[model samples]
Target: MAEWLNILLRSIGLFILVLLFARLMGKRQTSRMTFFDLITVIVIGVLTAAISLNLVNVLANGLIALAVWVFAPIGMYYLSIKSKMIRDIVQGRETVLVNHGKVLEDKLMEVRYTPEDLLSQLRKKNVFNFADVEFAIMEPSGEVSVLLKKDKQPITAKTLGVSVGHESVPQTVILDGVMMDEPLTAMGLNRQWLHTELEKIGVAPENVFIAQVDSAGQLYVDLFNDAIITPKPKTKDLLYVTLKKCQADCELYALGTKKKNAKKIYQESALELTEILDELEPLLKK
Candidate 1:
């Protein structure tokens, strides 16, 4: 009974020590383990078991051991933060795997990483070929950071000289065919307005896959079924179409004439585009 009590006490003490030790370490350190760190942890486990078996004085020995195990890392963390050299040695340094689109063979060998390993990490970031990378950095935590080549870099419509306004993450107004009341209220929208917008887009309320609202008060709707994704409409001549209408309504408008007037015209055209996008979105549900 006494031996069992000792074992139980030691087990609890050891767990408490490890928990405190881990909390003192950073999230990245715990998530990514190193050879030295793992060995040190194993030593702690062995000591914990030995103490538990009453090899050492149960109360005094276990308390001392637990205190050391808990506070040692906290001391090391202080040193690491104060000393740059210690920090680099403890956490390791970020290694450059590729510099200016060229792989550094010597650097790879020094870090004990292979071309295959680096390539695999790149693939995780959606880059398959070496030529597609401009720079690749191997962080000390075993994660890779990649920068793509100029030509391979993804270009949005804005980058391609297309006139696009600012974009932001859309707020979900409905999810899984259920109304999201909080989100709708946050966006100053309601279920009634949502239903009206869906009807305008020829989408039944039940058929909506997801309904999102942007800060610009535009509605984006997707369909639940995959068979009906029709491409969105593209205007061949937005300026000409809008200007002709604007001139008829108020003759004081041209594409570049009045700066503030041009902005208003642009906003109106953008609203129309968003409306058309809502109509076409239901077709591409798959």
Candidate 2:
């Protein structure tokens, strides 16, 4: 084979081989890679380059070395999974940077991270003041996990003792002016309902840039024309409110009516409507 053709063939074969080996090695994002992982990746790249450029005289020798590098970590990963001791040794234990609003100077030194480094990482996590941090630990991946003081933490529904409806993943029912039938059907909706929603909003499907239906059954739309502000549909909320009003009106009529039969009918109607509202509340509010 020609020199250039030989190099090209070698590169192509190695690329596919490495890709297969990489998948077998398992998936780990570059950002989340440990120091050990980074070194392994560098060595693999160097070996691949050497083999591709004919720096290694024996292709078989290069392949063996590549195999060792690729499989070693995979074995370690499995071992690590089965044993906590192996995992701690391989990945290294996370160092505590802060405990109960106090920065550990000794732990910082052990991790070879300065106070500024901790502050920088904390800032990235939206935590500016170290005093507010309840605990901060640097993981083996070098990412800092932060916990704020109880009082410093943001108030959630649970914290406030508020009863909130569950929210599922929002479905993208429309993308780039095209209706996505799968997502609509997944949400127990149809194209007819989508069309009706579009009509109610006074915007054509073609004009919509993107549309998503949240768990609350609210259709959120972004129009292609930014100049036009499309109003969000609150059909579920309106229906809920309308039902509540009707129930209230029925109760009022029951109290006001002089005839016993009319009063009994009104009371029964109100009670039935209240039951319906109770049943539908979960679906309406998310």
Candidate 3:
């Protein structure tokens, strides 16, 4: 009974100590952690476990071991921040795998990354064709950043010389059929306005699973049963949808046009569609 009591007290004390040390170490996530950061975490964990299990003078020895393991990494982290050279030495620099459509074979060998591994990473970034890539960099955190060739990149409104409005982050107004008063207040909205907006879509506040108001004052609602996901119409989305329909129709009309008069009609429709597309492009960019 006495031995069990000692174990219980020691476990509680060590748990609190470890928690405090974790908080002191800052908020660096496991995914973004460097090699040294990972090693420090593993060593601290092992030390804490070993100390907790040992019976002879466990409290004093465990505290000393835990402090040393935790503080050393904290000190090194500070030193790395103070010096760029130290930071590079501690966390290795990013490696360029591909440059201007040419693969850096020497750098790949240095990083010990196989051609298959590079191809796999490229595929994850949606670049299946090697020729489409302008730059491919392997970050120190083992994630790859890809840049596609200029000609292969998607066209934007700026390319068509169209003006686009600013976009704001969507704010949650309701969650799980409950109105979020704070978020609604932050968005400069009241319950009366929310009820009115919900009424417009034929959805009651209690029926909503989740609702968000976008920067354009468009309300998007998801029902509890998920039977409906209706979003308030925005001018930009309407124009883009119309533009796509026009393009599809133009293609069909071009294929069916057999007479000279029909061909002239198709050409006129195509020109009008192009003008509509130019106006719609800016909205799609946003």
Candidate 4:
């Protein structure tokens, strides 16, 4: 019974110690664990397990081993940042597998990677055709970063000489039916403005699951029951609404005016409405 109690207490203590050391190691070590980082984790696990099981009866020895494993990588990481040679040796430099659509056979053989392995990694990057790849680099963490040929890349606004204006990340103004006052205040918006925007989209404050305000001051609201009923207007629907308002105005001007040039003004409005409908027709087909 005393042996079982000892094991339990030691196990709990080691678990807490491991957790504390892991937190001190930082998030990058886990998320982007290199070959050296993996070795450090395995050694720590083995030492902790042996110590907890009383296989290594000296608690001080186990702790000393843990301290060395934990601090050594941290010290090396700092040194790696200071020295490029050490960084290259410790982290391993990125290897170019493919350059300008040509595979380096010698480099492939040196890395012990087969052509099939190269193709597999390329496919993972959504590049099935090797001819489309401008450069394929095997990063130190084993991730393949592929740069597609310029012609093969997706077209952007800049490519077409169009202005897209500045863009910024949308700020969350509300989450889970709760108003985030700090972000709303930071955005120079008050609860009254939020209420008005919610009303425009037919969403109540309490029913909103999440809400974000874009850089353009456009409020995007998602309600808890969105799957059943979407409160926001669709693109085509909004276009149709604008078209209807234009038609109503044209009729009002035609009826209310006694001037001779009133017909020309209504005709111009009708022409603009026709163009809007033409744009809406393609979206409606989708």
Candidate 5:
């Protein structure tokens, strides 16, 4: 009976220790879990359980040890934020993987990553060919950040040599089954205007999945019922056209690997964007 009781008490102590320690560590540390963090957690749990069955001051000692470990990271994080030196020590700086279509082998070695590993990360981003990548970065948190070759980049206003300011996201004036009064008022639209728009779209307020008005005064209406919604344009034709455009443009602007030029890959994307806009424009106008 005494042995059983001791086991029970130890189990309870282990559970409590893990709960408290886990809570102290932020969600990110646990969620994006690393090998070192997992091992540290296992060790703490085992140590707390072992001590729980021993001397009278076992609980107090365990708590104190847990507290020290818990706050130590917080203190380090605090110093890291305040001092550049400390920050470097805690979290290493970002490492560049590629520059100007050239692979930086030395940087890869510094990060202890092999060619296969780097390629694997790139493939995850849908970039299978190395020559297509102008820049790739492996952040300190083990996440990869990539910048495609200039020619592979989107034809944004700046890229097309056109000057344009920032574009704001559309405001949701109606959500679920209710109207957003604040957004309605801010956009110079009211309940009457919303009703008129819904009527034009052949959908009632109760039948809408979502409805919004953008800064350009374009109204986007999506209906909850498929029966009420207009039939969508054929995606197969649009997809083929878009893909061809992307491939062609990608080849023409081909900056990366010689195997697949920028013009050859993104040609289809151009056609698809144009087709999609044509279909959506009429719907919004209504």
Candidate 6:
């Protein structure tokens, strides 16, 4: 009975100590384990087990072993932040495996990485074709970072020479059929405005599962019942299209009209409309 009681007491005490040690180690160890981290984890596990099972005759010795494994890595990690040379020696340098869609066979062989292993890592990153890869490098954590060729990359506003507006993260104003006033207040909205929006869409506040208000003053609502469809907003995109068409119509009128008064009126309208569109372009297009 005394032997069983001792074992139980030891297990509880060691379990608590392990939790405290893990907290002190920080989250980097689990996020991306380096070569040294693996060794430290293994040694700590053995020491924890020895302490719990009373396999180590001296309790102090087992604890000392645990302390070294936990704290040494922390100290090295802090030193690594201050010194780049120390970091390179500890974590090793990243190796470039591919340059301009061509695999560097020498680098692969130096790292003992087979072609099959490279392909496996590339596939994990969703890069099926080697020809599409412009650059592929192996990180110290063994994770592969891939970059596609310039032509293979997705189109963006910068490539097309267009300016875009920046939108803030949408705030959840309604959740679980309850109106959250704090988010609505933060977004410069009120319950009356929300009620009006819900009424326009023919939806009740009770039916909503989640509702968010974006920077463009657009309300997005997800209801509990998926079968019912809600009407889409025709504010930004539709308004911009309509204004463009009106401007084009004015330009055509100015060209076709025989009367000088009508021609001047149409031309003036087109110029004024163009100025207005230029001001609103960033907000609508983005």
Better of 1 and 4 by TM-score: 4
The residue-by-residue lDDT of candidate 6 on 1-286, one tens digit each, is 5877888999999899999989999988799987778888889998898888889999998888889888888898889999999898778789999998999999999888999999998899888888889999988887889999999887998989887788899999899999999999999999999999999899999999999898887888999999998877656888799999999999999999999999999999999999989978988876
Each prediction's TM-score against the native? 0.55, 0.90, 0.75, 0.79, 0.61, 0.79
Report the lDDT tens digits of candidate 5 across residue range 1-286: 6977977877786677678767777785766544445555676656665666654355677667766766776687678889999776666667898988789999999988899999999999999999999999887677789899888876875566544433467889878867889998888889998887666656678766777787656577777765665533233345556555665565455454465545445545555655654655433332
lDDT of 5 at 279: 57
How much is the lDDT of residue 89 in candidate 6?
A: 76
Count backbone overlaps in model 5.
31
- Candidates' RMSD to native: 8.3, 2.4, 9.1, 5.8, 14.5, 3.8
User: In candidate 5, how many Å is residue 273 off?
Assistant: 28
Query: What's the lDDT for all of these models?
Result: 0.71, 0.90, 0.82, 0.84, 0.70, 0.90
What lDDT does candidate 4 reach at residue 95?
Answer: 93
Off-target runs (Cα >4 Å) in candidate 1 are 13-17, 32-59, 161-286
- TM-score of decoy 4: 0.79
Clash list (residue pairs), candidate 2 = none
Q: Summing lDDT over every window of 10 consecutive residues in candidate 1, give the lowest-scoring window.
A: 230-239
Candidate 6 ranges beyond 4 A from true positions: 1-16, 238-273
Model 3 scores a TM of: 0.75
* Tens digit of per-residue lDDT, candidate 4, span 1-286: 6988989999999999999999988898789877888888899999999989988878898789889999998899899999999999788889999999999999899788999999999999888899999999988887889999999998986798654446577889989999899888888899998998887767788898889987657777777885756554354456567777887788678777888698778867877777766655544423
Cα lDDT over the full model 1 = 0.71
**Overall local distance difference test of candidate 4:** 0.84
TM-score of candidate 6 relative to the true fold: 0.79
